[model samples]
Target chain A: MKKTKYRSQSGNAFLVAVSAVILGLIGGAVLMAAIGSNPFMGFYYLFRGGLMNIERIGNTLATATTLMLVGLSVAFAFKTGLFNIGASGQMLIGGLCATLVAHKVFLPRPLFLVVLVASALIGGALWGVIPGFLKARFNVHEVVATIMMNWIAYWSIYYFVPAYLKGPSLETESASIAISQSLRAPWLTKLFNGSYINYGFFIAIVCVIIIRFVLDKTTLGFGLKAVGSNRWCAEYAGIKVNRNVVISMMIAGGLAGLAGLTFYTGYSRNMQIGVMPAQGFDGIAVALLGASNPLGVLFSSLFFGILQSGKGFMNAMTSVPPEIADSIIAVIIYFTATSVLFQRFWDRIARRRGSRRADQREEE
Target chain B: MWSTLSSIFPYAIAYTIPLLITALGGLYSERSGVTNLGLEGLMLVGYFACAITIRLLQDTMAHSVWLLTLGLVASVVAGALFSLLHAFASINLQADQVISGTAINMLAGALTVYLARLISGSGNVRIRMGIIRKNIPFLSKIPIIGPLFFTQTYWTTWVVLAIWALSWLLLYKTSFGLRLRACGEHPSAVASAGVNVHRMRYFGVVMSGALAGLGGGVILITYSGEFHGTVAGLGFLSIAALIFGQWKPLGILGATFFFGSATTIANVSQVIPSLSVVPPVIFKIFPYVATLAALVLFSKKSAAPKASGQPF
Candidate 1:
C-alpha cells in the first residue's frame, strides 16, 4: 500500500509538470494572438527556427551546451539542499582566469588546454568555496552571501578587464585568447555549415552523465543526497554533512566555470567583461523545471535553447519584440516552481477516486 | 582640505539617495520574511516609468521639481503594483521564492527596455531638463557645515533621510512594527495568535516595491538624470547594502552612505592631482571590495529573521 501510494505521488508530480508546460505554452500562444500574430505561425516559426536548418540547429545546440553546464551547476548544489546563487560570479571569475591563461601564457595546445581547464576549475571552485565555508562554519545563509558575491565579481571583472587586459588599446573588451577556436565536432562541422557545434556539447553531455553517476552510484553522492533530504538525519547516519556541502558547491562552481569557458573559447573567442550573461540565474529555473534530475536538465536546457533561438525568428515574423520570450520563460518558471501545489491538488483527487472504487468493491 | 570636503559632500548625498531608499524597501520585505530579490527589477521599472512620465508631462507640469515629484509618486505606485506579481507567486501560489524573485528581475529588465523603446520610439530616452536644485535660504547660510549639509544637497536627499527615520520608527517603535517582526520571526506562531501571515507578507512586499521605486526615481531625477538599459544593476548594489547593513534600517542608511562615499571617492580620486597616480579602476573596485569584506566580517555575526526565506 505504501509503495502504491508512492508510485501515485510520482505520477502526480509528472502530471503537474506536464500540465504546467502545456499551460505556459498556451498562455504564450494567447499572448501572441493578442499581439496580432497567428499563434500557429508563431509556434511553427519557433520549431523551424530552432531545428529546421543546420545552422539553426548548431546555434541551438551551442546555446544549450552552456545552459546544460549551468543547470548542472545549480542542480549539484540543489542536490545538497544548497542554493548556489553565486554561479554567475563563479562563471565570471572562471572566464577571467581562462582568458588570462590563454592570453598571458604560451604553451602547446594540449598543455594549454590542461592549464586553462585547471585555472577555470580553481577560479570557480574558490568562488563557490567562500559561500560553502560560510554556510558550513557560520550558518550564514548562502542566498544572501552568494547574491552579494555576484555583484562583487561583476564589478571587479568590469574594472580589471578594462584596466589590465584591454589589449593595451581597446576600450571595452580584453584581448582574444591565443589559439581560441570553435570546438566543432567533425561530423557537426560538415552538417552545420561550419557552425560552432563544438566539443563543448560533448563535454556538457559527459558532465551530465558523470553528475548522474556520482549522485546515484557513489557514496559521496549518497551523503550529499542524504544531507539534502535532512541534515540532522544525514549527520546521525555518520555522514560529514558539512564536507559534503562544500564538495557539492565546489563541483557546482566548477561546472559553471566550464560553462564560461564553453562560451569564450568555444564560441565568442574573446573574454568580454562588464556583463556576464544571465545563464547562472536562468540555470535555477532550468534546474527546477527539470526537477533537479541530470537527464531532465539536458532536455530542459535544450528547450530553453530552442526558446532563445526561436526569439530571433519571432522578432522577424511579428510585431512582438524578442523579449516576449523572456516573459514566456518567466511565466513557465513561475508555474513550474509551484508544481508541488499542483501535485497536492491532483493527489487529493486521485485519492478520492481510489477511495470510491474501494467502497464500491466492498459494497459488491 | 575644507574645499575638498565640501565638494565631496553633495556628491555623497546624491549617490546615497537611491541606495538609501532601496535598502529601506528591502528592509520592509525582509522584516516580514519575504527576501525580495526583485528589488532591482522594481527599481528598474520605477526608473523607466519616471523617465517616460517626466518626458510626457514636462510641459504641463511646468516645474521640473513638480514633475520629479509626480514621477516619484508614479514610480512608487508602479513599483508596488509590479511587486504584487512577486508577492502573488511566492506568498499566495507558494512558488519558490528565489526563482520568483529572479523571474521578476528578468521581466523587469526586458520590460523596461521594451517600454523605453515603445515610449521614446527609440531604444534610449533622456530627460530634457534634469532635476533642479532648491535651497532653503536660512539653512544655506551657516558656516563650514552649511555647504556640506544644506547648500548643495538635493531635496531627494533630505526626503530619503526623512523616510529612513520614519521607517526606523515604524519598525521599532510602533505596534505595526511588533506585528511585522512577529510575522517574520515566526509566521506559524503569528497565525496561531490570529494574525494573518499572508496579509503581512503582502504588505511587506508592497512596501518594498514602493521604496525601491522611490530609489529608482531618485537615481533618474537627481543623479544620472536619465534612463538607460545599464541602470538595472544598481538595485543589486542596494541589496548588497541591505545585507551589509545587517538588515537594520539605520545600519542600511549608514551602509548606503558608506557605499555612496566610496563611489564618490572613486570618481573624485581620478580628478585629484596626487591621487591620479592610481588607476581609476582601482577606485572603481573599492566599493565592491568593501562590500565583500563587510560580508565576510559582519555576516557571520548577523542574526537574520528566523523565517526569512521560508514561504510560509
Candidate 2:
C-alpha cells in the first residue's frame, strides 16, 4: 500500500505536468488556426526551430542557462512557502555585481571567474535577504515589497549602466565583458559549434542536484519545507520559522543572481537599462510548470527556452506573428499555473474508473 | 514659493486621481478576502479597451467630452469582464490567489500587445487628446484655493473623487459592505450568517476590476494621451497606498496624494533648482523607495483582512 501510494504520487505529478503541456499545445494550435495558419506546420517549425541543427540546439541550451537558474530560484522559495517575486531585482543586482567585477577586477582566468560568480551570488543574496528580513521582522508582504524592489533595480540600472559603465558609443547598455572574463568557456563553446552555450548550464545542473538533495535529504531542507508546509506547526516543533524563511529567500535570491551573472556576462553579454529581465517573471511560470521541483524546473525551463528561442524562427517561417507565439506561451503558462483545476479533473476520472472496477469485482 | 507649490499641486492631484481609483479598487477585493494582485492586469485591460474605443470614435465623434465619458464606461466594463477570470480561478478552482493574479497580469500584458499589433499595426495605442483643462466658473474666482483646487482639473478628477465618496458610503454605511468585509475577515462566520461568501467575494473582486479599469481610463485620458500596453506599475503602487491607508477611504486619498507628489517631483524635478542636481532616475526611484518604506513602516500597524488570500 505504501509503495502504491508513492508510485501514485509520482505518477500523478508526471501526469499533471504532461497534461498541462498538452493543453498548452492545443491552445497554441487553436491560436495558430485562428490566424489562418496550419497548426501542425506552426508547431513543426516551433520545435524544429529549437532543434533543427547543432547550432540551433546549442542556442536553445544557452537561452535555457539563465532560465534554469531563475526557475530553481523560484522553486526553492516555493518549497519554503515564500514567493520571491524579487528574483528580477536579485538578477539585476547579481548581474550588476558580476559586471562590476568583470570590468574592474583583474585576475587569472580561474580566479577571475570565481570572483565573478561569488560576487553575483552575494549581490543576489543581499537583494533577496532584505525582503525576507522585512517579512520576518516587520510583516511586510514580499509580493508588494518585491514589486517595489523590481522598479528600484530597473531604474538603478537605467542610471548606473549609462553613468559608469557606458559602452564606447551606446548609452542604453554597459560595456561588454571581455571574452576570457565571461562565463562562456572556450571548450564548451567549441563543443556547441559556435552556439552561445556557456558554463552557466553546468552551474544550473549542479544547483539542481544540490537543491534536490537539500530539499529531500538534509535537516536544513527538511526544516525549511516544514516551515513552509505549516509555519505554526513547525514553530511548535521548535523550528525557527522566520530564520528558515530568510535563509530560503537568501539562497533563492543568490541562485537568481547567478542567473543574472550568466545572462549579463554570458548569454546577452551586457545588461541593458529601461528593461527588467522578463526571465524573472518567466521563472514564476517555470516553477509552476515544474510543480516547484528542481528536476521539473530544469526540464520546464528548457521547454520555455526552446519556445522563446524558436519564436523568431517561427515568425520568419509562418504567417503567424511573433506576438502570437508569445500569447501562446502566456496561455500555456496560464493553464499550467492553474494545475489545481486539472488535478480535480483527473481525480474525478480516476474515481469513476475505480468505482466501475469495484462494481465488476463485487459481481464476480 | 507658493506659486511653485501651486504649480506642482495640480499635477499632484491629477496623478492622485488614478492612484486613488486603483487603490479603492484594490480595497474592494482585499476587503472581500481575495488578494487581487491582478489589479495591474485588470487596469491594463481596461486602459487598452478604452484607448482602442476612444481612438476608433475620435474619427466620428463631434464632441470630445462624449467620447471621453463613453471611453471611461468601456474601461469599467472591460475591467469587470477581465476580472471574472481571477474570480473564477480563486473562488472556484481554489488556485493560489497570488499565482492566479500574476498569471492574469502576464496574460493581460501579452494579450493586449498582441491584439493591439494585430488591430492597429503599431507597437502602441495612440489617442489624440489635448488636455481638456477646466476652470470651475464659480470656484475659480475664490483666491488661493480656487486655482489649485478648481482650475485646470479634468472631469476625471471629479469623477474619481465621487467614487471615493461612494466607496466610503458603501463600505461604512451599508449591509452589503458589512457582509463583504465580513467575508474577507471570516468567511465561515459570514456563511453561518446565511450570506454567500463566494458571491460576496466575487462582487468585491468585480468591483475592484471596475474601479481599476476606470483608473486605467483616467490615467490614459488625464495623465498621458496614449496606451503603451503597460500601466507603469501603478497597480502595485496603489497597493502600497492601500496598505498605508490602513484600508480606509480617506486614508487612501492621503496615501495616493503622497505617492502622486513623489511621481510629480520625479517628472518635473529638472525644473526645480534644488532637485536639478539629482538624476531624474533618482526622482523615478523616489515613489518605489517610498513604497518600500511605507510597507515597512505601516505593515505592522496595518490591519489586513484576516482571511485575505484564503479561498472560501
Candidate 3:
C-alpha cells in the first residue's frame, strides 16, 4: 500500500507537469489568435522548422547542448538552494577565457582542449564563488549579488574582447581561435552537413549523467540537499552549510562555463562585443521547467532548443513572428511555477469527493 | 579637458537620470523583499508606451507640453500594470520570485518589441522632439555646478532628484516606511502587529514599476531621443546600480551618477587627447568594474533585510 501510494504521488506530479504544458500550449494558441495568425498552422510550421529537416535538427541539437549545460548549472545551484542568476555573466567570462586559451596558448590539440575547458570552468567558478562567499559569510543576498556580477561580467567581457583581443581591424570581436578547426569532430561535421554540431553534445550528455549520479549517489549531494531543505538541520547534523553552498555554486559555475565551450569551440569561435546572449536566462527557465533535476534539464533544454529552432520555421511559413515561441515559454514558466498551487487545489477537490462518496456508502 | 568635460556634462547628467530613477524604483521593491529584477522589462514597456503616447498626440497636442506630461503618466501606469503580473505571480501565487521575474522580463521584452513593430509599422520607432529642452535661466549661471548640474540639465533631471528626495523621505522618515521595512525584514512579525505584509509588498512593487516607467520616459525624451530594441539592456545596468547602492535611495543616486559618468566618459573619450590614448572600451568597463569592486567590498560588510528572498 505504501509503494502504491508513492507511485500515485509520482503519477500525480507527472500529470501536473503535463497539464501545465497543455495550459501553456493553449495560452500560446490564444496569443497566436490574438495576433491574427492561425494557431494550428503556426504550431505546424514550428515543428516543421525545428525537426523536419536534418540541418534544422542539427541546429536544434547544437543549441540544446549549450542550453543543457546552462540548465544543469542552474539546477545544481537550485538543488543547493542557491539562485545563480549570474550564469549569463559566468558563461560569457568562461567563453572569453576559453577563447583566449585556445588562441594564445600553444599546446597539443588534446591538451589545448583540456586547458581551455579548465580555464572556462575555473573562470565561471570564480565568478559564482563571489556570491556564494558573500551569502555564506556576510549574509548577503545571492540574488542581488549574482545579478550585479552578471552585469560586471558582461561589461568586463565587452571591454576585454574589443580592447585586448580584437582582430587587426580593431572591430568589436576577437579573431577565431587557432584550434577552432581542430576542435570539430569529423562525424558531427558530416552529420550536420557542415553545421557546427560537434562532440560537445556528447560531453553535455556525459555531464548530465555524472550530475545525476552525483546528486543521487554521493554523500556530498545529500549534504547539499540537506542544507538546501533546511540549513539549521544540516548544521545540527554536522554538515558545513557554508561549504556546501560554496561548493554547489562552484559546480554550477563550472557547468555554465562548459556551456561557453560549446559556443566558442563549436559555434561562434570568436568573442563578440555588445551581445549578451539569452542562454543563461533561458537556462533558468529550463531548470525550473525540469524541476531542477539533471536528467530533467536535458530533456527540457532540448524542448526549448526545438522551440527556438521551430520559431524560425514559424516565421518562414507564416506571418507569425518567432516571438510567439517566447510567449509560449513565458506561459509555460508561469504555469509551472504555479503548479504547486494547482496540485493543492486538486488534492482538496479529490478529498472532498472521496468524503462525499464515503458518506453515500454509509447511508446505503 | 575643459571643453571635453563641458561637452559631456549634459549627456552625463541625462544618462544618469534613467539609472537613478530606475534604481530608486528597485529600492522600493527590494525594501519590501521583492527583488525587482524585471526592471528591464518594465522600462521597455515604459519606453514604448511613452514614445507611442507622445507620437499619437504629436499633432493634436503638439502645442501643449502637457502632452509630454500625459505621456509620462501613461508610461508609469503602463509600467505599473506590467509589473502587476510579476507581483501577482511572485507575491500572491508564491511562485519562485526569480523565475516569475524572469518570465516577466521575457514577456515584457517580447510585448514591447511586438508592440513597437505594430505601432511604428517598422522595426524601430523615432519620436520628434517638440521643445523638449530649455535653459534653466538662473540655475544655469551657477559656475562649475551650473553646467554640470543646472544649465544643461534636462527637466527630467530635476524630476529625478525630486523623486529621489521624495522617496528618501517616504522610505526613511515615515510610519509607512517602518511598516514597509518591517515587511521586508520580518513579514510575519509585521503581520502580527496588524500590518498587512502583502499589501505593502504590492505597493512596493507597483511604486517600483512607476519609477522605472518614469526612468524609461526620461530616457526617451532626454538621451536616446527615440526608442528601439537596443534600449533593453540599460535596465539591467540600473539594477546593478541598485545593488551597488546597497538598496538605499540616496546611495543609489550616487551610484547612478558614478555609472553615468563612466558612461559619459566612455562616449567622449575620443575627444580628449590624453584619455584618447586609452582604449574607449576600457572606459566602458568603468561602471562594470566599479560595480564588481563595490559588490566585493560591500559583500563583506553589507547586511540585507532579514527576510529577504523569503516568500511571505
Candidate 4:
C-alpha cells in the first residue's frame, strides 16, 4: 500500500507537468492568434525548423549538449535543496580555464582533452564551492551569494579575455581555439556530416548516467536528498547537512563547468565577454520541468534545445516573430515551475476518489 | 579637489535613485515574510511597460513630463499586477520562492520583449525626451552641497528621495508597519493575534511591485534613456542593496548611495587621469566586489525578519 501510494504520487507529479506544458502551448497559441498569426503554422514551422535537416539536427544536439549539463547541474543542486543560480558564472569560469588550457597547454591529443576537461571541472567547482561554503559557514542565502558571484565572474571575464586571449583585430572575443584542441574531432564531424556535434554530447550522456547512479544508488546521494528534504531532521539523522551542501554545490558546479567546456570549446570554439550564458538560467526551467530527475532533465534539455534552435527558423519561415518563441518558452517555464499547485489539485482529487471507492466497497 | 568630488555627486545621486527605490521595494516584501527574488524581474517588467507607454503617449500627451509621469504610474500598476504571479506561486501554490522568482524574472523579460516585437516591430521600445532635469531657482544657489545635488536635473532623484522619506515613515511610524513587521518575524503569532498573515504578505508583495516598477521606469527615463530587452543586471544590484542594507529602508538608501558612488567612479574614472592607472574593468568590478564583501560581513549578523521566504 505504501509502494502504491508512492507510485501514485510520482504519477501525479508527471501528470501535473504534462498539464502545465499543455497550458503553456494553449496560452502561446492564443497569444499568436491575438497577434494575427496562425498558431498551427507557427508550431509546424517551429518543429520542422529544428528537425528538417541533418545539420539542423546536429546544431540542435550541440545546443542540447550544453543545456543538458547545465540542467543536470541545476537538477542536482535542486535535489539537494540548493538553488545554484550561479551556473552561468561557473560555466564562465570553467570555460575560461579550458580556454586558457587550449591556448597554453600542449600535450598529446587525448591527454590535452583530459586536461581541458579537468580544468573546467575544477574551475566550475571553485565557483560553486564559494557560495556553498558561505551558505554553510555563514548561513548566507545561496541565491544572493550566487547572484553576486555571477557579476564577479562576468567582470573577471570582461577583464581576462581581452588581456589574455584577444583575437586578431577583434576586441570583443578570444582567438578561436584550434579545432584540434577543441572537442570537435574529424571522425565525429564526418559522421554528423560536418555538423557542430562534438565530444560534449557523449560527455553529457555519461554525466547524466553517473548522476542518476549517484542520486539513486549512493549513500552520498541519500544524505544530500535527506538534507534537502529537511536540514534539521537530517542533522538529527546524523547527516552533516553543511558538508552535504558543499558537496552538492561542488558536484553541481562541476556539471555546469562541463557545460562551459562543451559550449566554448566544442560548440563555439571561442569565448566572448560581456554576455551571461542564457543556458545557466534556462537550465533552471529545464530542471523544474523535469521534476529535478536526472533522466527527466536529460529529456527536457533536448526538448528545450529544439525550441531554442527552432525559434530563429520559425521567425524566418512564418509571420510569427523571434521574440514570440522566447515568450512561448518563458510561458512554458512559468507554468511548469508553478506546477506544485497542480500537484496539490491532483492530490485532492486522488484522495477524494480513494475515499469514494472505500465508501462504495462498504456499501457493497 | 572638493569640486571634483562634487562633480561626481549628482551623478552618484542619479545612479542611486533606482537602486534605492528597488531595494526599498524589496524591503517591503521581505519584511512581510516573502523572499522576493522577483524584484529583478519586476523592475524589468516595470521598465518595459514604462518605455512602451511613454512611446505611445509621446504624441498624444502635450508635455513630456506628463507623459513620463503617466509612464511611471503605468509601470507601478503593471509591476504590481505582474508580482501577483510570485505572490500566487509562493503563497497559494507553496512553490519554492527562488524558483517562483526565477520564473517571474524569465517571464517578464521574454513577455515584454515579445510584446514589444508584436507591437513595435522591434524588440526595443525607445523615447528621446521623457527624461528631464530641472533646477529650483532658490534651492540651486545654496552652498557646496547645493551645486553637487541640484545640478544635472533629473526629477526622479528628488521624487525618489520623497518616496524614501515616506516609505521610512510608513515602515517605522505606522500601525500597518508594525503588523507587517510582525508578520515577517512571526506569522503564526500574527495570525494568533487576529491579524491575517496572507493579507499582510499580499500587501507587502504588491507594494514592492509598485515601488520597484517606479524604480524601473525611473531608470528608463533617467539613466538608460531608452528601453532595451534587458535591465543589464541593475535589478540584481538592487537585490544586493536590499541585503546589504539588512532589509531596512534607511540602510538600503545608504547602501544604494555607496553602490552609486562606486558606479559613478567607474563611469568617470576614464576621464580622471590619476585614477586611470587601473584598467577600466577593475572599476567595473568594484561594485560587485564590494557587494560580496558586504554580504559576507553582514550574513551572520543579519537581523532579517525570521519568517522570510516562508510559505505562510
Across residues B273-311, which tens digit of lDDT does each residue of candidate 3 receive? 766786776666666666656766775565455565467
Model 3, which residues run further than 4 Å from truth?
Answer: A1-13, A105-109, A167-170, A176-183, A352-364, B59-64, B120-122, B230-232, B277-303
lDDT string for model 3 (A51-85, tens) is 88787888889889889999999888888877887
Ranking by DockQ: 4, 2, 1, 3
TM-score of predicted chain B versus true chain B for each candidate: 0.94, 0.95, 0.95, 0.95
Docking class of 3: acceptable
Number of the predicted model whose DockQ against the real structure is largest: 4
| Model 2 lDDT per residue over B1-312, tens place | 688888888999998898899999999999999988899889999899889999889989947568888888999999999999899988887767877788788778877887776667665888888348888899988989997898888888888899899889999899989999998888999999999898998999999999999999888888788888788778888887887787788888988898888878878887888666777787677777876787777665567888888876
TM-score of each: 0.92, 0.94, 0.91, 0.95
- Ranked by lDDT, top first: 4, 2, 3, 1
Q: What DockQ do the predictions score, one after another?
A: 0.43, 0.48, 0.41, 0.52
| Model 4 agreement with the true structure over B217-260: per-residue lDDT tens digits | 99898878788878777778898888777788878988889887
| Deviation from native of the Cα of residue A193 in model 3, angstroms | 3.2
C-alpha lDDT score of every prediction, in listed order = 0.78, 0.84, 0.79, 0.85
Q: Which ten residues in a row have the lowest lDDT in candidate 4 chain A?
A: A1-10
Model 1 per-residue lDDT at B160: 83
| Model 1: DockQ vs. true structure | 0.43
CA RMSD per model (angstroms): 3.8, 3.6, 4.3, 3.3
| Per-residue accuracy of model 1 over B1-312 as CA lDDT, tens digit each | 678888788888898889889989998898898888889899988888888888899888765457778888988998999999889877888666777788788778766775565666455768877666766588778887678888766788888888889889999999888889888889999999898999999999999999998888788888787788656367877877887787888788888888888777777886776556776656555555666667667654555676876878
Structure candidate 1, residue pairs in collision: A183-A198, A183-A199, A184-A198
- The TM-score obtained by model 4 is 0.95
